[model samples]
Target chain A: MKMKYYSEAHEWIMIKDNEATIGISEYAAEELGDITYVELPIEEDDVTVGDTIGVIESVKAASDVYSPIGGTVTEVNAELEDNPGLINESAEKEGWICKLANIDVAEIGDMMTPDAYVKYLKSLD
Target chain B: MSDLEIKNTPLAECHKLAGAKMVDFSGWNMPVQYSDGILAEHKHTREKVGLFDICHMGEFRISGKAALEALDTIFARPVFNQRVGLCRYNFLLNKAGKVMDDLIVYRLAEEDFFIVVNAGTRAADSEMIQSQLPEDVVFEDVSDLTAKLDLQGPLAADILAKAGLKIADLPNYFNWTEAVINDIPVLLSRTGYTGELGFELYFDADKAADMWNYLLSFDGIKPIGLGARDTLRLECGYALYGHELTEDYTPLDAGYAPMLKLDDFPEREFTGKAALKALPVENKLIAITLEGRRAARAGADVLDASGTKIGIVTSGAFAPSLGAAIAMAYIESGKSLDIGDEVQLSAGRSTITGKISDLPFYKEGTVRKKL
Candidate 1:
């Protein structure tokens, strides 16, 4: 039940056992405005740490969503196809983009904790 | 580049105070979105009300007996027959049948006229018009001295009437009238780009701040930024000058053939009309809606079932009202694509399925209500 860490790119990983749930932070969603589309990585797609795994497009612009920990995409949220606005309504909750199974915990050290992420977001301003 | 000299409108400070996300738009420091966000602002305009600062647009005044004839020769649309207090949408074309700029002409009097041009194309439009006018015609660029504010929505008239102006007495759609709002002389026009019941207010730029504050003091009125303005217009199938109506695009290719009176007007007498008639249109503008949430953008290629590139998108975005991605593009004519025809849009890494749809992606609008 412990949330692991966050990335400066605005991705958050919630680790439970060897599986990790990933989605953008609320801060990122707010800045990006209305989410029009989410291009999630395919299942069983291998992703390395810091590698781009997906894309999020808003009315204004498109941004790449990066992987915080190296692993293979296990499941992608299919609801995004019809309800992209869910990302804006619940970025870190039901709007979770994908799940990564068999993730390498060693890569978590490279990410920041929730408290550090708050400070990291402030540094951007 | 000296930060590109972000010119400010009179409502620049007001936008900042409203927590708008400011961006540089063609050298003008303008708000792109507000704290309520582009979606909210767009929805407000569609369902209720939204106010916009359009002062950055350029305005010009022309007078004299020769002015009417000079304008008729300069624009692709007829101007001399336009009655006083009425406005007509027209385009300035190059000799090659390409559009130089799309503008609205307001016939102020028998010989005087006011031209409202796009903000980005002001200098070029003014220079082109001036160069084309006869020596006897008097032309003056009045952009710097004028300010424009567009109040648009279903409640626009009620809001204006509450502001001490009797909007009921104003002219009908595509018409204008002179009135005083709180002792401030203003030119009110029942014209807007959002496809909503709206009014465009023209007054002295020096008094813009006062008028802006006075309008905002009312309940349910909010300042909308350029972001919402664009989305609303796109939903209505209105073309953005630089994006859709460019110097390289002709009126025929942009779905303006109905407006062209080629048979009766004669191509030789009008600027660019001959070239337009000669250059057989290779493509036509069409509206498309994606099957899913993934939106196609400008520069995205339109492909046929065989993967052959057929066209390119001019403007695209996620339509808040429609809850889907919509776009406008020019596709090869005679492609057998009709309403409900399936197509594919290639956005680099992925291709999205789309269907040909009618313009004005959003259908629920109160733009042309009968008084």
Candidate 2:
């Protein structure tokens, strides 16, 4: 399924039947350079919109991954522990970091569509 | 920012064209990594070969009758006994035994010497060397006129051999030879920070682009950036200037006490020897390996099993070679931590368990192989 929304923090989320799967965008992974370690949030942890839920470290720098929607984390990708580069290979698909079952539908209003994200990236340059 | 404020290397535009991640490092716009990614570049350096643009490092030339005698007193390492083709690692020290900078001294001749220093401490190192030199010594900061490149890995020798230089003819470890690569006068040294068989080439800054492009034409060579350069070095347990070895830490306290020759060289004759001998070493640098993939980075707190704050991490990263996280830290001396001592590092809400191991984190390196 196509990514339904993107956050300014570089996270992309796909809405599927009221639930959402979230991961950092390919652009963010490319900028991070090398994924060394990831501090994923625990399952069932309550997260607010725009709150830092995890950390991603590259060889050069470290960045926080923010929750794009208010929800409780239902599942986390344990495969990232041994193979963090999956985020670089398939950021929006297989590399999704976590899944939230009860995401707020109104949170989509604060996110950007694919077209707007492309424009946002250009504005950065 | 104006162009006059900082200098750009010949490969600056090339880096931009390749979509490199740029960062302001020591007043230079350096590429931290290219599109291939830092971990891939680091693994390539270990398995095949990797090329690095190390032009940011500083170079200086000292020539005169007093140059030898002046350096003998200025640096911690011995200079008089060094042969013309050899190089020695030495430290520039402050009055209170703190390390100003760690440098490599290339003895060109009895009266001529070349000093390679860190990029961040170039200005201060130059001033310190000049001020300590006798009036007869002639010192020139040749950093602007020179550029350095490091070709490192198991295949480095084969790559250089294809470039028309017999790798065997080059000097052994810590030795250098002045040669011509592509008709550009270059100095090739059998030295590098990565724990691999490598060569460091120094040539005219203007010809850096030609040399860089020439090397990239090889089949297995790729342009690795500063990000990989850091991981490769960190895995080798080499002391980085700002992280492990700094103006505030002495070489002795930075796990180089055995390398120091205070008794043989005599402290009274050296620049900072008196203070170094008088000051008691408070902390000792140690290596730690985490139990899992979670890394504890610089400034992270190191604690014992009982939750006592034992030290602070100086440099830390995930080792691609070992598939584990490793770090270096300075802890209080006289507290014995064996090879398998249990330790924990706290990074915000998460804590990582690790064990004390003697450096380097990765063994089987080809850095000191016999020619």
Candidate 3:
């Protein structure tokens, strides 16, 4: 009933019963070094695929986080407001940025599998 | 520049082996951060000890009968009165009163001197200094053969003693001595970019990797990359070459007018003296503390209370030691702003608010501590 996929932009989306949680991939987080701030997307905002949902600020530079699947943001991780280092600690597991409801499952099929994403990271180097 | 054109220091292979994340810094293949990350490295340097690879910096030797008088005419600071074993922060300026480079001048002897400059401006600095010197002065670039390393923190002295250097024999602040560390002859200087009590060692290029591993072998010392180095210097309100001290601005704009000694020594004349006397300072460099962890990076606009742009940020970062964000900006001299004045910085999609503070957002540095 749960599935995970990764986008070419290095974002990960976990879908379960029409609701999806999103976060950046481990490779992306490692590249960011020490994350200082996370401008979380607002709840109740409608987002489309490939839209810039939020921003991630690291000690080095600022990076835009894009939405992988279109839906309405139902919840945001408020813990990141005070402790943004969570993303650097465990980007994929405990650092989920937001949860979106009514996501189109068809868009999830276009994402790469876990094994494929690992291969994709290899090709980057 | 292309990847093939990027130069490497002597310790590049050692850094790669230590899992450092390398980046291209000023055309040099340098390590920006190690596996422990920038924030951790910064904290470690403040609380413990850290080592840095600084071989890319340029050093020059100028010795002759007129070397002292020749240098006194070239720099904005007085060089003739400088005593042997003392180092002074000096500046080179163009005729139009623009800063060419900020360097350290060491009075090695009455006629012999050592100059250390930034890596990016080495060629230009050499050309400018060589052309201005007298025919009798001998100028030589000794950068390629020199390996530089900085052991910085409160425990730096203790670590040096552990490595076979006598703590009592170490030079005082802003002084240099020819000492032996672990049977290696080095020119050890009691100064560092970080506002910490530290020593910078200069030796043969072949001893880079060995010295790096030797110093870091201590329990208190860790290998820190340039990422933390930038943050540490910024927090201390030190002016970086390309950032706070650029060719587009003069020393007055960077709040270094007092160091120029224009009024203190009326008889002294140096390059750009007339231009500096004629030029009126248009900007005042100020420090600001951000409201939160977000940084106001360089090139970001600083706004007054009514949303009018008043200044531009030159350097910024979330200072790990302070637990808040800090930045240095040059505001219009015409603007009447005081310390603790509220200002806004436009960063990304957010307009973050901050308050103007004094230089050195982080205090309690051990740099001036008597050994």
Model 2 DockQ class:
medium
| Model 3 global lDDT (CA atoms, 0 to 1) | 0.92
Whole-model lDDT, model 1: 0.88
On residues B1-371, what C-alpha lDDT tens digit does candidate 3 reach at each position? 56359899999999999899999887788999999999999999999999999999999999999999999999989998899999999998998888899999999999999999999999899999999999999999999999999989999999988988788899999999998876789999999988999989999999889889888788978999999999999989999999888888889999888787689899998898888899898888899999998898999999999999999999988888888889999899889888999999999877899999987888989998888
User: Candidate 1 lDDT, tens digit per residue, A1-125?
Assistant: 67668988889999998999999999999999878888888999988888888889988888889888888899999998678889999999989999998887888986889999999988899
Candidate 1: tens digits of C-alpha lDDT, residues B227-255 = 88988999999999988899878999898
| Best-matching candidate per DockQ | 3
- Lowest lDDT sum, 10 consecutive residues, model 2 chain A, at A1-10
| Steric clash pairs (candidate 3) | none
Candidate 2 local lDDT, A1-125, one digit each (tens): 43588999899988887788899999998778778888788899989888888999877667889999989899999998778888888888888899888877887886999999999999988
* Candidate 2 displacement at residue B315 in angstroms: 0.7
Summarize candidate 2's per-residue lDDT along B85-150 as a digit string, tens digits.
Answer: 998899998888789999999999889999999988998999888989888899999998999999
- Superposed by TM-score, candidate 2 places the C-alpha of residue A92 at a distance from the truth, in angstroms, of 0.7
